[model samples]
Target: MKLLIGNKCYSSWSLRAWLLMRAAGIAFTEELVPLDTPDFKETVFAAAPGSGGTVPVLVDGGIAVWETLAIVEYLHERFPESGIWPRDPAARAHARAAANEMHAGFTALRGACPMNLGKRFGPRDRGPGVARDVERLAALWGQARERFGAGGPFLYGAFCAADAMFAPVVTRLDTYGIAVDPLSRDYMQAVLAHPAFREWLTAALAEPAIVAQDEVDEPALVDLRKS
Candidate 1:
């Protein structure tokens, strides 16, 4: 399997798929393509013929899979024992619902807090849209941790596909210094301290490419490249 991802610092979708595969201990080679480059479009199309100029494309054998959620589902089906989803059917269904919600919802928070692994900034005034999104996310995470995540710190207590699905959001909240409830904060810390997350962040810090458009926060900036 060969996974093609974008710049680790800014590509949320790439981070999601990469974390899932890494956490599952899937043996696969990775190809990193710097985003927003002159030949980025060409690189994507050439690497993933099915990717309509987007990223986190996983190619297994001869099959190319784009779309983070689709790639995740494919992995789960291909390796059922990998425990991508929960072992319990009801828990699996609940996890699926959260992942799907993350995939198709949270536009406001996503727009406001794009993940930037190599950068840190001071807190900013949260807009109403982003604030609402944050509140909803905190509530969901709080409830999930209480109801289903009793075995461990992850959403389902075992770092399943559901955890990978929200890993970027963890980074986003941390990057922006967004305050959440205690339960959500602890969950975020658990994800932040995961080995796979650290690996990705380290790689991202080493990347030299700087896509200017993604540098949204400017106050008291510190580059993790030097950290």
Candidate 2:
């Protein structure tokens, strides 16, 4: 299987699919197409003909699955023993719901603070929209951890598709210096410290390609990419 993704530094969606597969030990080769390049659309379209020219397209032989959620489902179905989702039926349902909510919601925070792994910003009041989004995120995470995360630090005990879905959100919270409750903070720490996340972050920092839109206007407190 070959997963076609975008730049590690700026592609949050790509990180979702890549992190899930990598953490699950699902062996698959990856191809990175730097975003905003001249032939990005063409390259993605060629690789995933009907994917709406998006990143994180997983191609397994003749089957090409696009969209991060679809990719998660595909992998879960393909490798049931991989434990991509939770083993319990209730936990599995909640995990899927949480992942889908992440997929569709949280545009306010996403717009205010795009996921940039190389820089850290001093937190400030972005806006009411951002504040609301952050509040919701914390509550959502807290709910998951309280209900199903006793087995491990992740949302659903062990790292699963739901954690993969929110992994980039974890980056956004840390990068923008957004504060969360202790539970959420601990969950975020676990995500950031994960081996899969560390591998992705290291590669992201080394990436020279910069997406201008994703780069915020605020001055960065720490620019680790320069260091």
Best by TM-score: 2
State the local distance difference test value for candidate 1. 0.88
What lDDT tens digits, residue by residue, belong to model 1 across residues 1-227?
A: 99999999999999999999999999899998888888887988887785787898999987989899999999999999897999988788989999999999999988877788887777887799999988889878877787788889898889998899899999988888888888888899999999999999888888888888888846646777776
By summed lDDT, which 10 consecutive residues of candidate 2 come out lowest? 47-56
Lowest summed lDDT over 10 consecutive residues: which window, candidate 1? Answer: 217-226
Model 1, residue 85: distance off in Å is: 0.4
State each model's CA lDDT, in order.
0.88, 0.93
Q: TM-scores, in order shown?
A: 0.96, 0.98
Candidate 2 lDDT, tens digit per residue, 42-100?
99899888779989899999999999999999999999999899999999999999999
lDDT of 1 at 4: 93
